[model samples]
Target: MNPPIDDRKEYSNNFLSTNSPIYERFSQHTPRCHRGFDLRVWLNNEKNLTRTTCFCPPSFYGDMCQYQNQRISLTIQFRVLSDSWSTLFAIIVSLIDHSKQRIIHSYEQFTYL
Candidate 1:
């Protein structure tokens, strides 16, 4: 026999839980809070259609907030030093901007003797 469904667990990507703060204050039904908008509307309002629009906050974008937005700039510098026994290896330097709307990702290696 098949197992019975569980009502406690919710599986909606678009709508928040019924107990969510936004839903409790602004909406009587589950609400959507992602992507480029936060949407809330009565599920039983088919007979009386209503329209609303909500925009996403900073660092958020896309139709369902499925992607992260960022801007990046990189700078690299190199230097070498000499030692009595042997020559010091080259050193690498990296500079990056980490603004609110920007992300920095990088990888590097350095060696010295």
Candidate 2:
């Protein structure tokens, strides 16, 4: 005759629970914030479709690629920080033209450190 399933629990001395501290530590490292940019694209021609894409260097992150209609706008925002300081270094904004494939306007500011 076979014993019940619960009877096996007595043979094992060590049992792990779900609310362990290890579980908490794993969740803490997950990504909680998202940073990026918004760009606006205005196409000159109606028949031609325009596509825009952006590339970010090291220490930067944002939305790089986007599609446009008649008047398309994208916002790009990134967090800049210094190694020794615990504050933001600057903010950058880039306005691109998808139809012409070029940057129309670019701006940057370093107000706080």
Candidate 3:
């Protein structure tokens, strides 16, 4: 009996020429995803493969895996004392939780002049 032929090339070509806004690329550094396949073996096997949506970083989120995930924003400000050489700084880290509420983690420090 003959083995089933792989039609991934044709499927990929068709996907690329489609009017869909999604773009596909293959990379070995795809981030961890519960729904993704284990590619450790595939990575060690071949390097002559075409690009596909199977590999995408965690910073990206989408059906076709083209959109970028929103990231937590961090801001830091430093001020110097006029009388002495002490430094005053404030660090603020803000992350949006799954419930759409803002969660902030802040650290402030100052040196005695």
lDDT of 2 by residue, 12-84 (tens): 4335445768767876763322322333355656766555444444444456423222333666675655565
Off by over 4 Å in 3: 1-53, 57-67, 71-82, 98-113
Candidate 3 per-residue C-alpha lDDT over 2-108 given as tens digits, one digit per residue, 9 for 90 to 100? 44456766665776653544533343345544344334333334665443344556876654455777655655455656775655444433343446555544444
TM-score (all chains, Cα) for each model: 0.27, 0.22, 0.27
Best by TM-score: 3
- Cα lDDT of candidate 3 equals 0.50
Per-residue lDDT of candidate 1, residues 60-94 (tens digit): 66555656776555565545454464765665644
Per-candidate clashes, comma-separated: 2, 12, 0
Q: Is 1 or 2 the stronger prediction by lDDT?
A: 1
After superposing candidate 2, which stretches have Cα over 4 Å from the reference? 1-3, 8-14, 32-113
Full candidate order by TM-score, most accurate first: 3, 1, 2
Q: List the residue pairs that clash in candidate 1.
A: 35-64, 35-65
